[model samples]
Target: MDVQIVHEIFFMASLIFFGGMVGGAIAQKFELPDVVLYLLVGILLGPYGMNVLNVANGSLTVKLILTVGTSFILYLGGREVKIRVIKRVWVTIFLLSTIGVLISTFIVGYTSHLLLGIPFSIALLLGAIISPTDPATLVPIFKQYKIKKKVAQTVSSESAFNDAVGSVLFFTFLNVITSGHLSLEHSFVLFLKDTSFGIGIGLLIGIFGTVLISQSDYGFLKNFSPIMSIFVAITSYLVAESLGGSGFMASFVSGMVCGNKVYIGMKCNLENRKVQETVNETTGLILRMMIFIVLGTMIDFNIIFNHFWINLFIIFIFMFVARPLTIFTSTLPDGRADWHWNEMLFMCWVRETGVMPAALTGMLMGMNIPYLSHIVGIAFMTIIITLLVQATTTNIVADKLGLIDK
Candidate 1:
């Protein structure tokens, strides 16, 4: 890389960090999520708006930062999942992450294809891209509102796991579209293989990390446990991806195991707790700021203008019709989940598109897929609208439903 490019990257990073601090304060004052404000700032200063921070959409630096940021986000999300909570809501999380994603994907895909006259393949790709909820976006809202434990676990776990599912489905549909063929058996096998391997890699790494932490003899080693934890998280993700597994799933599982101290057979001590808190607070905040800003920079005004009505229509259907239908239908079966009516309704409205979809859309743009511009435009619009609408109103909805902690 050129020296000038390196300097520019650092300059941009400083700007993003500064902007995020200001945006977060403004959001808090207005009782809104910081993510919405961060995104708006990005759009305002990004190339499309003021060209103040002109990072190329397809640049290696952007992609590298996004990849690292996404991995850390998933790792932190996984760490948030407690074993007891998972045991309580495992069935619900499983159903919502898998069947629920499919339900939303097909409904949105088929409906959009019919309404917009786009090919079913392209519609499906779009649906898969946007199917998974983003924990990076939601975890903050959950924390800010101090949402109910059960509700938070369900949302966080589903978001973390379904991200892997959504990625698998996205690629599966992408293949079908590119090759002009669809095979259910083949797709299922691929999904199973990717998910299982990813989980397996994560378990292995998690166990190793737990044992390492447990055996640390020196105070220095104990203090270094947090750094070791981060190392394990990132390594698990990269190693799993290199082995044709879901890196997202691997990272999530690693964090979950390490966070719960499953291998060590103990609760996290104060130092360990501080490590987790500091890592989650600092890393998550920085990554989200960078990713959302880069996402804003990628937004093209012309495409949004050309497809304005269609974009609005798709967002409407996904948010209101498809998301609600998926939540109710998937969780309706007895013994599926422990959600009451209010909880279910809150969950239904909690679907905000975030990092995963934005990252995947960027990848899709690189693939030169059919309707690439439209897909990117729609995906970008969905992120903005969902963050603006759902994120902003999330606290109020929680309060109304009494899901917020007193």
Candidate 2:
């Protein structure tokens, strides 16, 4: 509306487009994940580095972009999930996403509280914030390395599911910490409602979307099928959120339904498939670039440096101790899916935090929670370390484990 605001918007858009193009290309040339390049570019141009692109942390615009961008990433991740695979391994995925997240959260939370002398509430909040693995970071590794199909699917699906779980947990704990009034019973009810309603809305819309695409064969309808899928994703997310549901879960389910059923129905139409893949990939790339770049801009070196040792300690514990404990415990029960030691180890190490944690940290900062700086510093460090360590080394791990395709 205001002239300055319009100019700022235009400037940010231009920077993201041109910067992403250059950074993405360079990352590909070096065989690195584009996320790394995007983040570095963000830091270089952002307030922390050059002060060239002054996007304020926790601003309304940043929050909106993150919300939409993360929803899109989750939807894309879900679309790649195969229903057949889920049926066979749903128990494993469920245990990994839910029980696994809880275990990681408590382990990290209790340790932080005891070691750092922070309140148990704040420590729990931190644990919840960083618990979920990011699908956006892992998708590239899976695609680039041609990792074993089952392993990739498990990781991707678990990432998507746990993001929703982690988000719900984060907000629940945030409310408990801030207000100190919510009962466990009430929180459980809220969790149930969020999950169930989200699934309901997603299934309904997904079915509607599938029918919409499948029953239409007009040239214009076929041409716009990809756009239509995106429309469904955004609409489903908004609708679910407005009704007090988990928008992330809803968008994921909608995308999964549309991708597997509706998209598959068009198998006979090669042109349609190509158009869908091209458009979806392009859109996903742009969103990821924008998200990571914005994430880079939010980092404050002062906070990170102030708590450097603790941050490093947290990352080490999360990667080496907490994650392994959760994965091993969750998969140990009888009748759970049996996985090889290599697969289990790979799963433990694939715990990279990404956009969701960044978004949650921004939201918490906006809330002005106590010990905010420490929480944010730990989160930022966890993200950087995990991406640097886990994401970059995924292919190597797969190769060592003989999980990479020949």
Candidate 3:
């Protein structure tokens, strides 16, 4: 890369980071999730608003920022889903993330095909692209709100795990579109391959991380607990991807293991957990801000507005019809979870389309695939609409549903 490009990169990074901090401040003052403001800040600095930074969509810098930022955030999300709590709802979580994503994809796909006249395969691809709810968006909202434990954990955990399912389905369908083959058995095998390796690798690394820093006799590296968390996250993610697994799943699984050291039978005498937490908090903040800001800058208003009515109508079905059907169908059958209507309703309202979908669309941006512009437009619009509507109203809805913890 040339010096000018390098300089531009640093300059853009600085603006994004600084803008994030400011957005965070404003978010706090109004008691809102910071993601909304981070996106707005990005729009402010991006080509549409100020014509400041014309950072090309799917550029290396954009990809790199999103890749690193989302992985770390996902790891943090995994940490929040305690094994003890998850066990009670494991079946629900599993079905919700896996089968639930598939269900969602089909609902949105068929609905869009009939309504917008989009080709069935392309519509299915669109559904797959947006099926996974974003954990980066959820974790912060959970932290800010005091939703009931079961509801919160289920939603957050679903967001973390479904990214794997969503990705596999997207690729599988993409293959279908290109090659005109839809193999159910192949899809199942592919999903298994990615998740198994991802969780397997994560388990090994999480165990390794725990032993390295646990206050056990062998924990010579205990002093660097904070730094080790970073090492663990990045290593798990890269290793899983290297092995053709879901890197996001690996990161989340590793995070779960790291957070609950007792589950791993480690005598974590790490007295510096507080400091480790501080580091993670700061790091997550920076990442969350950058992810959304970059998403903001990537928007193409011309395409978005060109198909404004059709895209908006699709989003309407996406948020309401498809999501509710998917959630109720997935959750109601899990007799073990015995979900309350309100809790299920809260889960229904809280599925914010965010970083995962944004990243998937970004990956597709460079391709000359049919309906690519529509895909990009709808995906980004989903991000904006969900963040603005569902995310912002979370507290109010939680309070209304009486799902709040307090």
Candidate 4:
């Protein structure tokens, strides 16, 4: 590693830590999502503002930051998914995460091709890029504003699941777009094989983590209960990815099991639970800080301006048209969870584009994908607009929909 880059690694990390803490305070005071402010703080500190935090957009440094931040955020997002609640609405969650993403991809894809005159393949790439709702953004907002439990859990779980699926979908398209050798059969096989391996790894490791921290005679790591979940979280992701699985799903499932320790036979004593919450919250807050701020710092406004007006219009369609279409299509069919119109509507407005898209954008940039400027510009705008409009308005939307907890 270059000496200057090492200095940069330390310097940027310090800035994000201090800057994120201060921005967090501001978010709490004004009742804004922490991610929105973290992004602004980054913009203020980056090339566009102070010009001090000038890091190359697709440099190794940015990629490193995103990799750590993305997985950790997924870990935290997974913790939000309680298995008990999941059992009731698993059908709805499944449809929303899998089939819902597909619906969103085509809707936005065709719309992009028609309006921008891009090929359908490249346009679908855009759709896949922005397909998943961001758990990094959604998890915190739901945590801050108490919405109806079922609604919050469902949205949070969907974000985590779809993030994994969206990632698989993105790379699948990348192979087709770049290599020009498309195979539906191969794609289908890869999807199943990867997702299944991911789930298997997560459940297996999560069970181990749980047993290790249990109050049984064999529970050796009970004293290290606080960090055991972390162990499971990181270990599962690495193991799953190593074995050709979704690391995102691994982290999430591990989190889900660790969170509901009782489901996995771990006794949730008060002291243990308290310590786990503190560590999780602190870690999650910092990861959110690093991910979004780094993302904001990397937004090259010049690229974003190439199709500024049209990008805004496309994002507008994504949030209003495609999102609602997805929500209705996925959730309306599930007869298991008695659905309400307002709750479904609330789900529509809450899907913000954040970490995963930014992470995927970073990967795309590193690959020097065609239409680099256009795809990134649209993605950046999606992050900004969705965070501004949907994230900022989360409380009001939930309140209006009568979904906020009393």
- Please list the C-alpha lDDT of all candidates, in the order they appear: 0.82, 0.82, 0.84, 0.84
Q: Candidate 2, TM-score vs. the true structure?
A: 0.94
lDDT of 2 at 196: 84
Clashes of each: 0, 0, 2, 0
lDDT score, residue 290, model 2? Answer: 92
* Per-residue C-alpha lDDT of model 2 across residues 1-406, encoded as one tens digit per residue: 6998989999999998898999989989988888988888888988878877777777888888888887888788878788777676777888888999999898889878877788888898999999999988888879998988878888898898898788878877877777776577877777788888788888888777666555455333555678877887888889998998888778888878876874456332467667877888898898999988888888888989986887788778888999999888766672556678898888887888998898788777577688898899889888888887777788888889888988
* Rank by lDDT (best first): 3, 4, 2, 1
- Local error of candidate 3 at residue 195 (angstroms): 1.9
Runs in model 1 deviating more than 4 A are 178-181, 215-221, 262-269, 336-338
Q: Can you tell me which runs of candidate 4 are displaced by over 4 Å?
A: 1-4
TM-score of 1: 0.94
Clashing pairs in 3: 215-268, 215-269
The count of backbone overlaps in candidate 1 is: 0
Please list all clashing residue pairs in model 1, or write none if there are none. Answer: none
**lDDT score for residue 185 of model 3:** 80
lDDT of 3 by residue, 247-304 (tens): 8778888998888887767776546787888899888888888889988888888988
> Stretches of candidate 2 above 4 Å error?
216-223, 262-270, 334-336
Instruction: Between candidates 2 and 4, name the one with more favorable TM-score.
Output: 4
Candidate 2 minimal-lDDT segment of 10 residues: 213-222
